[model samples]
Target: MSRRSLLGLGELALLPGGAAAPLNAGPLNGALSDDGDLARIGHRWRALATRPGTAAVRAIAPTATSLWPDLPYPSYTETPARLLAMARTGDPALADPVARGIEHYVRHVYTPGASADGNWWNWRIGIPRRLLEAALLIGPSRADRPLVEAVDHFVHPCHLAAYEGHSTAANRVDLCQVMLLRAVVGADPARAALAASALTPVFPYVSEGDGLYRDGTFIQHSTVPYQGGYGRVLLSGLATLFAVLRGTRWATSDQRVFDLVEKSFAPFMHDGFCMDLVSGRGIGRHPYGDRRRGREVAQAVLLLGESASPAERTRWRGLVRGWGFADLAPEAETVEPAEGHRLMAMSARAVHRRREWVAGLSMASYRIAHYEHGNGENLRGWHTGAGMLYWWARGHREQYSDHFWQSVDPYRLPGTTVSTLRLPDGAGAAWGGECPPARWVGGATDGHFACVGQHLYGLGSTLEAFKSWFFLDDAVLCLGAGIRCADGVPVETIVDNRRTDAALTLGGGWAHLAGHGGYVVDGPLRTLREERGTVRRAYTTLWLDHGTDPDAASYRYLLLPGASPELTRARAADPGWVDVLANTDRGQGVSVASAGLTAVNFWQPGTVGPLTASAPCAVLVRERGDGTATLTVADPRRDLDGLTVTWDRPVAAVVRGHPLLTRARTGRRLTLRWGRLADRGGSSKTVVVRLQSAK
Candidate 1:
């Protein structure tokens, strides 16, 4: 019943190899007074490190190759480095298993081939390529040349230059590993090229400042019943990338990364809470992840040890513990034994001599960061930012900040821990986190979200917390569906208090969202009278309340991306598609023509379910020449936003505009290239050209 958590280290001692340490604390920053409660934390870390366990850590060690999870598979080969860490700690009792796990990680997670790969895997490119941090954690002494080669191979080609010669979600993971790879390997030619080339995508192509990140959102075209939340890959990826660049010795290598981290770091934390910039908002206090806070402490401790400013490390410590306030309740929280060892392994830089500061910093940081009220975005993440957040959490607080807090055994679920939502209509659907399944309907991109993938991700998807994202053009809207204001309440109208009816709060009733953004929709747009919670407007545009963060206060509306509208008319189009566009202004020509225009929202303030699709989303009746039946879509972003008219066969609609995001052409009978995002603040015109489709 110790308030302090523990990892089930039973698997550590049973390794097949020789002696190994139960844990390696990693680097520490001595940013604290020589004596005090912090010193006590240091002692605790020491005692925890010595605590017996890791039976399996030894069995998995020794193999030259990295390991991958058998069932769920692994996201990276960090598990191997994690194992070597056990051996380095000199735990004596856990060497064997630790070594074996290391072997398995390299062999399974890193190999690139159909045989070793998971059904849906980025591992071949993810594990080894990104294992540099893991290798560093294990120390250069333990990282064999093969491991290094694996790391290099994975990142250089797969991660850095995979999609369209730019960074995609997968690329982000690649880049994430690059930090550690570069860290352990030093600045070689390959490393420099990787860094420079990857650098372009990081900025302007990706983040907030310039393009460090892709400034937008997207929804995968599936058929389940979900849309991407505030971010893709959960928003955690973005933050993690920041932590890695800043934590490892690489902090000085790239000023852009450093600056991005510093600038975005504040919003990512937020008074301790780590919510998705989009949704996943939590109230109350905050909490920290075991790994992330630990990493911050490690870095802070290292800085302190190296004679860095004491204030900076101490400040980071406070922020570290503050992370654990409200979101996340990983299965590990319920486990016993090795959890303690895992925690120590993640935080204690024991071999580094003066790591006492690490213990204190980690504890304080975890306490604050972990408990912060949030749905998950910052925890597991909920946007294109997932790679960044993951890198941060896994690199630093695998035990707390990221999915490790939620994962029972890091080695158990591995890659499976991360998943995407079902296509709103049940097409090719998959999801993560916990919850009850929701309904599906015909909308813009695909169908809709499971309405449950959010909860499974621990971000309360019912509230529209977790989601995946992908981008083709600069314009994207990978975002979340809104949740209600009354915290702890569901968005179902049937459940009343638990439900946030669209008609209840009006346009952001609980959100304090206000903007003058206008959009252009072909033909006469229907206008809905505004009420308390919901508003009957032509197209549902996104509004940001800023959640009390003045810095993050920003607004954007969806717009025409790439769908070519073939036909059009008042309030609804004939048989066409609605293309989404993007802009940062707050003014444009807007309308709600049918045949392809929809709006989906994450963290939508008020709602009810199965929401009456009667208002926001309407079924437009349409037909094909041969007598096939299909539905025209309008505003697919909204849970009930799309207005569709079905046809018997295929239809060709050219949706043109500035703010388009993605194209979704999935359906048994009809294909759709719906808007990824539309209605940005700008004046625009629409040209509709109708055509028939091929079955």
Candidate 2:
């Protein structure tokens, strides 16, 4: 047997009494400068903190109650591992549940009979995700024979001869395990040397870029975009890397490495939410989830807070709070933080409270809540991976469609999916679904666009075929959806199921997409050459592209499911929208609703002509034609909750000099109500209006 064969995972090492020195207290006070910049900007953060009502007990998942092997792993089970780690450091509070967490992992991580080999389990083995995970947990000295043998087999044709090392991003995960094993086995030089040998070939995967898109920044494999929550995986990779560095002696704290990681994460922080983008028209599915891989980034940022400059701390805090990840909050409703959460909270120990109540509120107006789609495409937010690369973002990105299994980890959640990565000690949401009697799919077409660093960048698209991109923090979002084409089967839809209030404002802060991507574009918008993933060309993926070439198509109705729309008073409406071009698969003319702005060309690339035909569809006419002329189209596929329009600007309309409640205001003009639609009982109530030009 190889020397590494002797070392096994789960082995605990006793620190040499004479050799190891006790680590000292880390930076606990605020950043070095105590710069008031964050304090000032954070004034808003502090004000929003302690947001009330996030704590009201929510209804539980009625059906998911009795589900077993529920979440691949609750992650909460790692409590024992956490307690042991913490107890060794002299922290007493880490005990109670920690033991239970460990026990859970031992019991559930590998359920016998679940796999072909009674002793072996599918813990994502075919995919090799767990091998890397185990490698990260196993240190140099402690190598489980089976685990080492498994790692040996998992490594693809590479220098170290391991599939675990095949993926640069995956290797990062293994990096952590290798160190963990080393620590467990007393960090013997021999084990460290062997582990280092294995890690050698994997370093080339790290690209000079800040971060990767959809995958790691390694230049070789980055060409293919995997979207659908790939960002969360990146987050997991970084988190694992950080833990490995801190836990094992294999790596030293490198400022450059950490800086790059931080800079790579920059794009996620928009306004206050780790915004996928500021705005878009439909439920743009930028599935940057709130948890998953990002949890590690949160932890790393928190740890950096200890030694960070005041400005850095402020920035880090903003990133953490900006992700719109209330679920990760200790007080979140759907999900709660325990030991893993503690790691995140404490890591930010360097974070100083400017105000006792400052909270994180994404300046980006939840974009998905804006436009409605009947399809389930936009709902990837909760289950998908993080914007900065967390698993849930990927899960959500992949969960809604038939391709959802691509995003499934085989181990996660209480049911449906995520059973593959299940770890007894892992922490995850028990219930992740909308409260309703309906769980509908296939209504509208959804798409995603993001600009993470090359390390992780790409857009999630439902167009040709469902595909996604992550790690593109530097790019802009461009997505168009056809809620209902002239001829297409209708679908059941829901727009704002998760949000508390239904905001109908068209233009606001950064677009807040609930489970999809949204965009608010104006000015010199940059154009991106489509970087299609391999799946984009798959016949079954984009069934629409059966034989049509995108370049030759005269009119394309990129289907946008009209599920549900958030009806609010803030969004704008263009009543003057003209019918540009309407192409239907069935060659039938669709009913252009005057209420929701049937269709308008806000911005066309190159020289795509405007809708030449006077639109029976809703149109937006600026008093002087400055804002935009929007033509809206509703979901013929499904009935929308409601359709309301807000002008580009705020207007308090006065008819005969009397200001009224419901009026379309844009750019300082008097907003007389143009049109409105209400879903009283699943049926729409249409409101009509005429522009009297009171001005």
Per-residue lDDT of 1-695 in model 2, one digit per residue for the tens? 11111111001113321112112122111221142221121121112111222222212121222112333343322322232333233222322232233323334433232233321213223222332222222211122333344333433224234433233544333443443342222313444444444444433333222123222121112221211133334344443333333333444233433453343444333222322221111114433342233454454454444333566655555555544443233232321111110000000000001111111111000111211112343333332221112212211322222222233221221111011211232122221111111111111111111111000101111111111111111111112122221112211111111111223223332233333323232221121112222333111111121121121122111111111224211121321222223332111122122322222221111111222211112222222232223222222212333333333333333222212224444344322342222211111112223233335
Query: What is the Cα-based lDDT of residue 141 in candidate 2?
Result: 18
Off by over 4 Å in 2: 1-167, 183-187, 194-263, 269-296, 304-488, 491-606, 609-695
Total clashes in model 2, counting residue pairs 3 or more apart in sequence or in different chains: 193
Model 1: residues >4 Å from true position, as ranges? 1-109, 112-116, 119-126, 129-132, 139-143, 149-159, 162-166, 179-189, 205-695
TM-scores of all models? 0.34, 0.35
Provide C-alpha RMSD values for all models, in order: 21.9, 20.3
What TM-score does prediction 2 earn?
Answer: 0.35
Residue 627 CA displacement from its true place in model 1, Å: 64
State each model's CA lDDT, in order: 0.27, 0.25
Worst 10 residues of 2 by lDDT: 341-350
The per-residue C-alpha lDDT of model 1 at residue 144 equals 43
